[model samples]
Target chain A: MATNTEITSRDSSAAERRGAGTAERRGNAGEPPIRPPVDIREDGEGITLCADMPGVSKDRLNLRVDGNTLVIEGTARLELAENEEALYADVRSSVYQRTFALSGELETGKIEATLKDGVLTVRIPKRLELRPRKIEVQAS
Target chain B: MFSIASSASDSLFDELWQLQQQVDELFGSWTSSSGGIRSLPRGSFPAVNIGHTPERVDVYLFAPGLDPKTLDISIQQNLLTVTGTREIPTEEQATYYRQERFSGEFRRVIALPEDIDPDRVHAKYRDGVVQIGVERREAARPRQIEIH
Candidate 1:
């Protein structure tokens, strides 16, 4: 029942709200307005993306580009102090999750993601057969 | 003489104390090492965020690259359990490369407060995130006192 424009507008508003607040206040439960900023630039035959996912370790993160949807899910387990009580009076955990729907031009199998200092950068190159090529005119 | 109201309050407190003791006894007798994994089979417990508002309790779970049909959720007593497994990616054409993704059985259990109405719980899954809203029972909701 929802139109695409309506959904996009809502997403934009949520993004704005996330941008307006402190990083901690950006996201809560049940909604995902806050996400690590990512820049996807087109290279000669591929795309390079850099995402800031602080506190996420290589063991806790997963990246999969299935079809046209790129799924990113991970856990950021905060170290509990030894002296602190087991029960939490405030937030119990921190989460870092994001999902992006990529365009058809993306080559899923060629994508590569690397985590460095909590930042995730993914490079996806187009298939050699998929890239556009200019044809030379046949000599008369 | 002690008022009847005071006696009733004392009885209620006693009941609550007994319930707490019973919960503690059951959980304590279990052989579960707290740090040991409680996952179902072949999946990992993704990150989750839980929030409590006055009227409702909200829970969000992050799990992608999973089939919704494979995911199972159940509420027994005050415990909410989510369990499922994801298929491992297998490719015959690609050369040797690094693989870093979880695929297996996973289970996550959350204890709900006594105030939550089990019958009023509603859940929805979208965009690989599961959201559950548990509404408080009517009797547990706060009402303004009327001035005589």
Candidate 2:
């Protein structure tokens, strides 16, 4: 379970959105972990969610919507083979994953995502009822 | 008779070689493990670069167009982990002539040296790149003492 501080902190900042709790268990002699940050912005119509995942190509990425939850997943292809040791390897290729729960007020079917210049953006539109509609008053 | 060989053929060969490399990459998934759960391979991982200075170790990652908020970084037991996910793109009533990019969850883990002091780690994000500065433990720093 995530702590309240963790939830709010994670939700509040661009760097905290992806809460990589692996540091808590680094004591284990296993592997280290990596978590990239994501940002979400909501406007009158919908919310724009952005993520940074480098080295992942269109063929390797996957997105799915299940019930009220949206899931994103991706894997980075190894540019160089194991036998070839790069003199300088500055990019880290790894798996990417994220999940967001949609409220009933949102129109799940209208959600859309796009990957441009290495950033993945998901736009989730709100339901008509949730949006502020112009109310017409009868002439008295 | 004209020369049988032409420059076009040479260029075609170059294109063929590039295409062959792409084809090879398509057949092979980015994943290194058979379990199919992990997004990528393990170890220091290749794409990221770590530089060591006299007082600190600098880690740099090449990531473009990624929102800083979606990134998560953790250092524990001399290991650093970065994890996050990318959503699939959707458009309404639009036809695509060509499309290629991967979207989904990803996790990257890097091993660290024992001389690092996690508490002193500082990170900066710029131009789609992440740079982390980890201060070295006192014992790890170079020291010169005068002979008595």
Candidate 3:
């Protein structure tokens, strides 16, 4: 199960709520914006973010980095047969939005992103100075 | 008459809520076969939405990043089972700070309120969601009679 901490932290912020509200208002009638579950990990190089964004294709997904925040938005496309009406619907079709706060150590300019099988993987490399380095000791 | 209808609807909602709780329990109590460790029961992943129309009942499973070939759907009596597995290629020498997406085999079984025609059941997976439609039995459908 995905941890709820990241979602809770972002959701409790007024700025994040405003961003979400703006996205919802731009969506189709009765459709609300959803925050896709995400997994963030740190490694020797930097951090990797994996987001589950099913039904969102390459063209429909958008990623932006502004200052210290990274914003992800995607629209899911679902097609239903003609003359079909939903009777019980737990899944609502809508846009996906999420934001992450990044530190200055990250090299935002070189961030790489890819989408496959509806999962989005983003690799944010660290600044050269932030990477751990080993110093050689002279033998006396 | 209005009171009777309202009460009937209330009962239906109650039944649905009970079923949801049962599903949560079933999925939560399972033991991991590989690790031999007990995993904490968490909220349902790949959440589902169930709806019914006069003609049939529709089930929508929200699962993304699933290969269509790996998905298995079976219906026996009033039970509907959906099974599938997801595999993510391991990154060489990459250590994770947090791992959340569910991987490995997963099976979910749901009980229907009425018997359905298996032959008429149709399922389609698109845009990361599986849509299953099961036709209600002839006897269960509403019927109209002519006055003599």
Candidate 4:
């Protein structure tokens, strides 16, 4: 949900990419979720978001947007044969999740998402009225 | 008197520096000269997980947004190295609000515990993760000997 603070700060550069949510819900499947690194950019049209999610496939990836809340979730599968024994381990969790309370100015219905090379790209265009427009100046 | 006091402080500082290094090592994974920077105290590109079996070692490296043709994996004795380059997609006239993904050449060299057969190494890249399986040295086998 968009709060007054979140709505007013939507124009700020920090809020633009903070498409990374402040209210985080983690710890599922026995381990804490890995907060996948994300990048956000804004143009005259809307916001473009890219999240790095290695080991995630198209089938395992799930992205949802609801009432200004954007959620990204995926599971990373690591194969270990029956005979293989673990010597060293680092990736403790297979789940990756992130939530973002989006600005009200965005057109959630027009969001486009694509997954490639284990990276997720989500494009949410701004509302037509909210987008920047050039104002023609009359002859002085 | 000042010169002698300064030398004493210098030695003390050296001892403190070594102690700090030891503490860092104890707290993190002593992977190499860089130590444990895998999203811990420090962050490293293409985070990796290594495991072993009776025959071979298994390695999984997580890195997204890379060209498959650029990946290179090499094994020399016990050292295994994976290197590649990730180029940022060109964005014209776009203003970035946040950039966190790593884009550039990345190299990870790990010294394994036992010698590995260089020819027995098998590596595959899929979905942005590289899986490396290396067979241990064939010469290492327990033998039974008769003793009087």
Output the better candidate (2/4) by DockQ.
Answer: 4
lDDT of 3 by residue, B1-148 (tens): 9999999999999998787666434333221221112221233556665556567877777787788789999998877888898776657677776577776788767665465777788888765777788998888878899899
Tens digit per residue, CA lDDT, model 4, A40-133:
9999999999999887776566677756798887777666665554454455566778988899899987788777777888888999998998
Q: In terms of lDDT, which candidate is strongest?
A: 4
User: Interface Cα RMSD per model, in Å?
Assistant: 11.4, 12.5, 8.4, 4.3
Where does the lowest 10-residue lDDT sum fall in candidate 2 chain B? B27-36
Candidate 4 differs from the real structure by a C-alpha RMSD in angstroms, to one decimal, of: 9.3
Candidate 1's iRMSD: 11.4
lDDT of each: 0.55, 0.55, 0.67, 0.71
Say which docking band candidate 3 falls in.
acceptable
lDDT of 1 by residue, A1-140 (tens): 11111111112233333333223332323333235555555645776665545445565555665457776654543332222222211222245557777777767766777765445767777878877688999999
Prediction 1: B-chain TM-score: 0.65
Clash pairs, candidate 1, are B41-B105, B42-B104, B42-B105, B43-B104, B43-B105
lDDT of 4 at B7: 97
**TM-score of candidate 1 to 2 decimals:** 0.46
Worst window of 10 by summed lDDT in candidate 1 chain B? B27-36
Model 1, docking class: incorrect
Best by TM-score: 4
lDDT of model 1 at position B71: 80
lDDT at position A19, candidate 4: 27
The TM-scores, one per candidate, come to 0.46, 0.39, 0.64, 0.73
